[model samples]
Structure formats: C-alpha cells, structure tokens
Target: MITIKDLNKNFGKKEVLKNINLKIEKQDHIALIGYNGSGKTTLIKLILDLLTTKKGKIEINNLNIKDNKFNLKNICYISNENDLPENMRVVTYVDYILKLTLGRENKLTELSELFNFDIYSSTLIRDLSTGMRQKLKICTSLCFEQDLYIFDEITSGLDPVSKTKLINYINTELITKTVIYCSHILEEIVEVCSKAIILNQKQISDVITINDKDKFINQYNQSFDIGDLNHE
Candidate 1:
C-alpha cells in the first residue's frame, strides 16, 4: 500500500504537484492519465523518489520512500527515459536484472517464450527493433515478480498483437500486484485498469472506478473537451 499526503513539488518558480493526497491499496491497478506537462510524470517520480518533494509524506507499506530506498526493491519502474546498455544482449540484460533483484538466475526461458520474443540470445539490444526492445524491457520488468509495478507509457511503440498479449498477461499473471501505469491511451486504460485518475490544473481532477466501464467512459469523454475521443 502507498499513502501520499500533502505532496508538493516546485521547480524554481513553478509548482508541479500541489498538496496531493492519495491512497493506493495493495492489488490496485490504477491508470494515471492527463495531458502532457499536467504533472502526471512528476507525481510518479515523487513516489519513486526520482525527484525530491518540497512538502509531503510518502509512505509505501509503512516505509517512507526517503528512508527505504533499498527496501523498494519490491517496486519496479519501467520508464521511457531509462534505457538498457546498447551492447548488452536481450537475454543477458534480462538475466542481469533478475540476478541483481532476485539474487538468482531463473525464468529466463519461460518469459522469453511467453512474450514470443525470439531474438538471438546474444543479439545486442541496440540492434533490436523498437517494438522488440520495448518487449524486452517489459519482459525484464515482469520477470522479477515485484509487488509494485510502475509503467510510464510502456505500450507506446507496441503493435496491436503485442499490446493485447501484454494486457492479457498483466490481467492474468499480475492479479494480486499493485500496478500503476501512466498512459495517454484511454482504450488501453479502460481495458486493463480498475480505477483511473485524471490529472489537471496541477492536481488530481478526477478519480473514477470503472464498474460499468462503457458508461464511465461516456461520462469521462463528455467531461473533457480535447477534440474527438479517438475510439478504436
């Protein structure tokens, strides 16, 4: 569980997060959505301790982000800006990540097969296509079985088949985990997330649960006027 209270951040004269308060329980799959520069990423960074908070209290399962950096091994963050070493093979990179987190080499073959990723075990990451590389990154993150999974626009470059496969995998395999994903893709969020948060005006504008998702989506679309809602 994660509890944030009065969370605030500032960059020189501009404020990013403003007195944000949220409570995320275990097994909550939440999708954070907002327009670019609306502070969605900043809030995630604050929770991950990638950015320092000017004023707030962030607690992860009774452990503070500041004091429990090492204990956060239970959390996995797959961000767009973070990249694997170009020279590392896909398999080797996954293996290294597993070894570093779990202190053992395990499940490499199973996960690769599950994702239908068949790149040579020795192929360098730099040579893989963008979709393939994203698949590898997602595979590596899921291999460790972390309690908290944070994916920031993780499905950006994925094809339709890959996207469906990944979403199904998350629903089936990660039933008990807390997954917080930030994406501008509404359809994906509606399909996978049980709850949604809309960030606007430097604060959480709305938080809605999708009990009757179609109706929820209709209302959600009507609430914001940002051009036609692209439905697929």
Candidate 2:
C-alpha cells in the first residue's frame, strides 16, 4: 500500500503539487490521468524518490519514502522515455538489469513469448524499433516481480494488436500486481484500471472507481467536453 499525505513540491518559486493526499491499496490498478504539465510525471518522480518533496510525507507499506528508500526495493518504474544503452543487446540488457535488481540470471523466455517479440537475443538495443524497445521495457519490469509497478505513457508506440496483448497480460497474469499507470488515453484507462485519479491544478482533482466503465466513461467525456473518445 502507498500513503501520501500533504504532499507538496516546487521548482524554484513555482509549485508543481500542493497538499496532495492519497492512499493506494495493494492490488489496486490505478490510472493517473492528466494533461501534459499537470504534474502527473512530477508526482511519479516524487514517489520514485527521483525528486525531493518540499513538504508532506510519502510512505510505501508504512516505510517512509524519504527515510526508507533502500528498504523499498519492491517497486519497479518504467519511465516514458527509453534509455537503454545503444550497443547492448536486448537479452544482455535484461540479464544485466535482473542481476542488478534481483541478483539472479534467469532467461525471460516467458515474457518474450508473451509479447511475441522477434528480436534476436544478440541484437543491440539501438537496432530495435520503438515498439520493440517499449515491449522490452515492459518485459524487464515484469521480470523484476515487484509488488508495485509504475508505467508512464507505456503504450505510446505500440500497434493495436501489441497493445491488446500487453493489456491482457497485465489484467490476467499480473492481476495481483499493484499497478499505477499514467496515460492520456482514456479508453485504455477505463478498460484496465479499477480506479482513476485525475490530476489538475497541481493536485488530484477527482478520484473515481470505475464500477460501470462504459457509463462512467460517457459521463466523463461529456463532463470534460473532450470530443469523441479517441482510443488510438
């Protein structure tokens, strides 16, 4: 579980987040939605300890983020941007990451098979397409077997088929994994997430559980004046 209280952040004199309070329980699949620059990425950074919070507290399973970062290894974060080493092969990269984070060297055959990724284990990261790299990122994160997974704009470059497969894997095989995904795609959010949090004005503007997703989505679209829901 993740608990955030009175969270506040500022860049120089400009505030990015203000007095944010949230509690995320285990097995909760949450979708963090917001326009660009609405503090979605900033909040994720704060949770990952990539940025310092000027005020408030963040705790993961009762361990304070500020004080117990080392103890909180049960978390995996996949950033929006891919930053793999240009010359490292896909398989080697996964192996390295697993060794660093999990202290074991196991082949990610299950993950590769799930994604239908055809890239050779010897192919360098720079040789892979954007979609392939994104698939690799997801595979690596899942292989870590962390309690909490964070995915930021993860489906940006995948085709419809690939995206569907990934979503199905997350919903089925990873049902017990706590996931917090951020995306501009509302349809994807409505389909995969059990809860939705809207970030606005530097704070969480709304928290909604999607019991009747189709109805909730229709109302949300009408309320926000966002023209025809665009899944692609």
Candidate 3:
C-alpha cells in the first residue's frame, strides 16, 4: 500500500537517511526498528509528507506523494502525545478526529472505554496524566477506520495493562490493516508485526520475516549487542 524508492533525507549538511527503499503490501503489519536517532521518525514523517521529499520518491496506494495526489484520509498516524490538542476537552478532540477521518463518532465510546479513557471525556488534555494522554491519543487515532495506520512510539507512557489492551486490540481488530509500527519494545514488535525492518546507520540494514518470536528477539538483541530491547 506504501512504496518508497531511493529515499534520502538531510537537515543542512547532516544526512539523516540514505537510499531507503521499502514496500509495504496491503494488510502487511511491519515493525520499523532502529536505535535512537537512527531516523525512524524522519522516515515516517517523510512517508506521511510531514517533511518535504526533495531526495527521492514516496507513493501511497500507487499515487505519488510528491504529486500531492494521494489522499491521506485513509491513513491514520498516532504519534507524540504532546502534539494533541492540549486546549480541547477529550470528547471534543475525539469528535474532531472522527470528523477529520470521516469516521463515526459513535465509535469513540467503545474505543474510549477500551482504553479506560471514558472517564476523562470531559477533562482537558493538558490536565491528564502522561499515560492518560497516551491512551487518549490511541483512542482518538484508532476510533477511526483507516487502511494504513502508522504508530510511532505509541506505547510510551502507557501502563502495562493499557499496553496489553492495545496489543490485544491490534492482534485481533487490526489483522487486516496495513501498519508501520515503530517501537523499542522488541516483544511488542514481535507480537504485533509479521515482518521487521531494521534501520541502522541511516539506511535499511535488514528486513526479516518474523517466524519465531523468541528466535527473532534473540537475533535482534545480538545484532544490536544489547541484552534487553524490550524497554523504550
């Protein structure tokens, strides 16, 4: 559903990514893994057209993103909680997101409940706890119906219980949706994604089909020379 070719990104003279090529097929759940400052977020922003594409090509649903012809209404991106509407009430922000995505507002109730965010419906975003705000972001983003979902560090600040809820939801409800999941939590990646895309040294270093969770985790830990990659 998404294709990138010969992609390169730079800020001033500092190059962030180079020659990044990827293809995400329909209904494919992909884990985008990288160390801090490995340009995972930059790559995602490039895909979302949040950043200008000067070096290469990115296409969504076969339409070139550079052409400004691709409709992102079908894409849902959940990222930084700080980016949420801090001034808006939870319910109001949910309504706005539903409207923006052309999704049913009724779905908000179920999603909010699932994330245990219903009680905060009248609470100002800025007043909520970090975990609550993260749940709010997840609830708002997933309440909509979209073909492609991109989550960047989505589980950050989420409690263990809430994180499990999200994992179960994705494993069950999003089985057929295309997703680009970015996280440092290796176990979560192993559970939610069918394939892993490893970004290292400003480029895609490996793309591995995940067959065994334990085996993949072992390999991943060894590759990065780290004992534990399950934490953000």
As a whole number from 0 to 100, the lDDT of residue 203 in candidate 3 is 94
Give the per-residue lDDT of model 1 (tens digit) for 1-232: 9999998889988988787999999999998887788898899988888789659999998888888354767888886664779888876776677667664344545666777886347889988888778878877777786899998988867888888988888788887899998887788887778898878788888888876667767767755543443334
* TM-score-based ranking: 3, 1, 2
Put down candidate 2 lDDT per residue, 49-94, tens digits, no spaces.
8899669989898888877445556788886596778899877887
lDDT of each: 0.80, 0.80, 0.85
Clashes of each: 0, 0, 0
The CA lDDT at 129 in model 2 is: 86
Clashing pairs in 2: none
What is the per-residue lDDT of model 3 for residues 91-153, given as tens digits with 9 covering 90 to 100?
Answer: 787767766766466677788888877734688989988888888878777877889999998
Q: Give me the runs in candidate 2 sitting further than 4 Å from their true place.
A: 101-107, 118-120, 222-225, 228-231
- Say which prediction, candidate 1 or candidate 3, comes out ahead on lDDT: 3
Candidate 3, poorest ten consecutive residues by summed lDDT: 223-232
TM-score of each: 0.90, 0.90, 0.93
